[model samples]
Target: MAVNNMAVQGKFITFEGSEGCGKSTQSKLLLEYLKAKGLDVQLIREPGGVAISEKIRSLLLDKANAVMNKECETLLYMAARAQLVEEVIIPRLTNGVILLCDRFLDSTLAYQGYGCGVPVEGIRSMGLFAAKGIQPDLTILLDLDVEEGLLRRGAERDRIELRSLDYHNRVRKGYLDMARKEPARMMVIDGSQAKDVIFTQMCARVEQLLS
Candidate 1:
């Protein structure tokens, strides 16, 4: 996949991994830390950050939409991302805001590209087009087993979460492969560690980025 890995003006960091990898928690923690230091920061999530994107998120996550076409689902995600990047991400970052996003292009590559069998090149083209050259400066991948991550999510599951174990495994492998290819921009953290330890390591990464 020929992804446009160009660096944007401000610091943009994204968190990625399988569902229920504690990224939400870690993101919030990092946000709190940045705020304490009085840095100008903005936090967001994929597929549901902005109002328009939130609507698309509901359709994508609804279990009743199991029959949704893979390509269609993929496009819907890109639509949400396009709106988010236009309405929220790009503007704030243009003013030099430090962005701590919960997820980004990597999720699509892992879920739809690897999980649902969409070609990486196609997803790359569509995603880069949608986001308008925006790319994270750093991506922290919280690596974990599919089973354990799902177990943490509990009985309630989204449509994507209900996919087969093999599918989830492929997604995890896809993330690892990306990390291997872009070690400087993507760090794979062991998600099985204690929450505090994980956060500490995450903080260290963010510190390095900020410094």
Candidate 2:
């Protein structure tokens, strides 16, 4: 199976970016596009897609859990990921299902590792345990300015969203840095562009993998 790049196996494609980067929206569009093409595909949002993982997601995003430590937050994300990988990702990929995910390990690297002051190397090292050594074949990143991105989110932000602007800026930089390091695996798209334009670019990239 192709673990790191696009190949003929069950392709795991993840959409990543800051809070309002439109990763979720565009991922859904890609999901519908693939379905319309009669492809076997499904979409899974991180910290979700499974019963156990969803519970962890609740705790992770709850504003009441404001006292959650960076280390605690990091492990919780991993715990949720471990459940998700075991329950959703591994089996589907093994069955040759094209999985379109809203977020994955990259979010942890950006949010906790960079935004929360945890070490990037540590996040990568721990990610193996959570992801079970199965990584994305393609990672599509929706990049945009931190301020504009947060503005797009509007009110009713979650715990992570309520963090300081500096933290979010660090997270954004982390994503760009990761994308820069692995140009072949991660594709960067301008989130500020129109949805159709972004979807077109995303579709062209995905078609190459499907072909």
Candidate 3:
């Protein structure tokens, strides 16, 4: 892919976590914080951020699609990602625009592969192709109790969120395993901590990268 050779002048940061772990809120806050520091930053989300990808996101999340198999789910995610990478992410990063993504390739690995029993090796290969060689500079994985996270989500749950507790637990485990294997790139934060505390910790890690 020609996009692979493009110089990434800005940082690419992504947030990962189980449902209702506050990654969306945290990513938003980080976006604001980065803007306050006068940096050129934008917040985009997986399965979204572009018109085509956003439609795919809706299809993937709609509870009506309950019968969708793991293979179809995984392919849809990759389709959206490929569009997002080509349409928005690559060009922005090439122009030195810092990007804060709510979720990325890791979500597929955890949700479809680990949680839904899809083959991990296959997902990794597809993810690499979908992302077109654009890897996150930093990944913040927010760790939280599955039950508590579900409680936070309340009655409003998407297709993925409506999965069994065991499934979500497996997803969390997958995330932690990945973090353990790549400690330098993935930072696991205690999502149970106070919002301000978590924010501060996130800032510290991000600033270290910026410096």
Q: Candidate 3's residue-wise lDDT over 1-211, tens digit each?
A: 1356766788899999999899999999999999999999999998899999999999999999999998999999999999999999888988888899999999999999889989989998998898888899999999999999999989989999888999999999999999999999999999999999999999999999999
CA RMSD, predictions in order: 2.6, 2.3, 1.4
Which residue segments of model 2 deviate by more than 4 Å?
A: 2-8
**Candidate lDDT (C-alpha), each:** 0.90, 0.91, 0.93
Kindly list the per-residue Cα lDDT of model 2 for residues 48-161, writing each as its tens digit. Answer: 789999999999999999999999999999999999988888879978899999999999999999898899899998998778688888999999998898898898899999
On lDDT, the leading prediction is 3
Which regions of candidate 3 fall more than 4 Å away from where they truly are? Answer: 1-3
Q: Backbone clash tally for model 2?
A: 0
Query: Which structure is stronger by TM-score: 1 or 2?
Result: 2
* Most accurate candidate by TM-score: 3
Error of 2 at 193 (Å): 0.6
> Considering lDDT, which of the candidate structures 1 and 3 is the better prediction for this target?
3
Q: What are the TM-scores, per candidate, against the unseen true structure?
A: 0.95, 0.96, 0.97
Q: How well does candidate 3 match the true structure in TM-score terms?
A: 0.97
Runs of candidate 1 exceeding 4 Å displacement: 1-8
